[model samples]
Target: MTALPIHPDQRTPSDTSVPVSESFVSIQGEGKLTGVPSWFLRLAGCNLRCRWCDTPYASWEPESVSRPVDELCEEMRATGLRHAVLTGGEPMIFPQLLPLTERLHRMGVHITIETAGTVTRPGVRCHLMSLSPKLANSTPVGDPRDPSGKWAERHEHRRLNFASLNELIAGSPDRQIKFVVTGPDDLPEIESVLARVDGWKPDDIILMPEGVTVPDPDEVAWVVEACRTRGWRYGDRLHIRLFGDTKGT
Candidate 1:
């Protein structure tokens, strides 16, 4: 990660590389800077496979084709929005995202990233980072070629990235930690993970209820109280509330 100095006059490069699914301008629907107008750069790839993921369209499937970094920056510029959010199945899956983020920052756009926190890239000064680590309950799609024991071993290796990422975020001031809480069945595991990440503070950690398909008030209440009792924050599923699991909003 080169520490490229951000300058307003930096020219958009002519090189056409990297893939982008779509870029749109919309108010951030979740996390610390909620309701803020932000140009969303939805990159198209992910390493972790969460069972309750809503963006399966952007996960493994080939969506709309790739566009160069400069062209994507141009689309964000056209939005006339000063803030941008780079989100995806996992934005950090691509290192090119760091350069793109640097270019956007040079253009004077405040950048935020909503990621699964299983991957990290250098040189991106995220104004805010929302990191959600995948838990054991969310298993990757199993391949028959690999035995169950082998699958478990591989899964542990992949999921360890989340812990490394969480460690990095512990000292980052602009970063927030979030976990998708499903049920009481998941609470003990969530607590264990939280205990492992010593950097996570109660105020900086949030619990977001899973299953946006239907609003689960019971789960929501449980999360709210757990946050309250534990001195953590409770994050609302704003997009679900706004559009009810609709895509491309």
Candidate 2:
């Protein structure tokens, strides 16, 4: 598979065009608002490439239909669901999101923007900002597709942006800081991240296991114990458990 070029800078409203991978209605699978009925709009494109990325189709190649702001709003309105989630390879990279979210809010829809927390848009509005910052574990190794370790270096440099994370946390009315835990080794990294952010309660943090389908039982147990000990929350990939790794959930 061929990976597409990365667009790290924020786009403009006049150039408010978005590449949409897919959109569907599904229960909130992870983070603070789990089990809530919601509509997901998965936008295409991302800057960093994680080793265990689940949505490679949406990120690696990023082949998607160019949808205008009005068309996207129409789809969201047609869903007739009050809860809507704007997810992506990274949604904030597109300036079109600002207007799209504004429309959703006007329709009285509660919006959740899921992101890697490496980018932020001040004008974008979201009821909940689900921030999942990538860690060292995300660095891709020697894969035949990217043997030059380019993705590894890029992922490392661009994975964590404390400025963006802080802004998203402060801007959103409700927020959750989710960290993908691959194993016990990643615990310290999580703590390091927590130390950087101020004014966050234990309940605001969520630890999720890194897996495509259902999380491993052993990993879940360890994460549960860690969450219990730290007074944080444990997140399960509910969509993976319920609908497997298939798209359009």
Q: How does each model score on lDDT?
A: 0.70, 0.83
Q: Give a tens-digit lDDT track for model 2, residues 100-202.
A: 8776777888889999989878667688888898989988877555788887788899999998898778777888889888888999989998888765789
Candidate 1 clashing pairs?
A: none
Residue-wise C-alpha lDDT for candidate 1, range 16-129, written one tens digit per residue: 456666777767777778788888878777776555567876764637567888888888888888888888878877767756877787798887788877665644556677
lDDT of 1 at 26: 65
Q: Pick the candidate with the highest lDDT.
A: 2
TM-score of each: 0.84, 0.91
Error of 1 at 222 (Å): 1.4
Cα RMSDs, all models:
4.0, 5.9
User: What is the Å distance of residue 25 in model 1 from its true position?
Assistant: 1.7
Candidate 2 residue-wise lDDT at 129: 84
Query: How many clashes would you count in candidate 1?
Result: 0
State the local distance difference test value for candidate 1: 0.70
Stretches of model 2 off by over 4 angstroms after superposition: 1-15
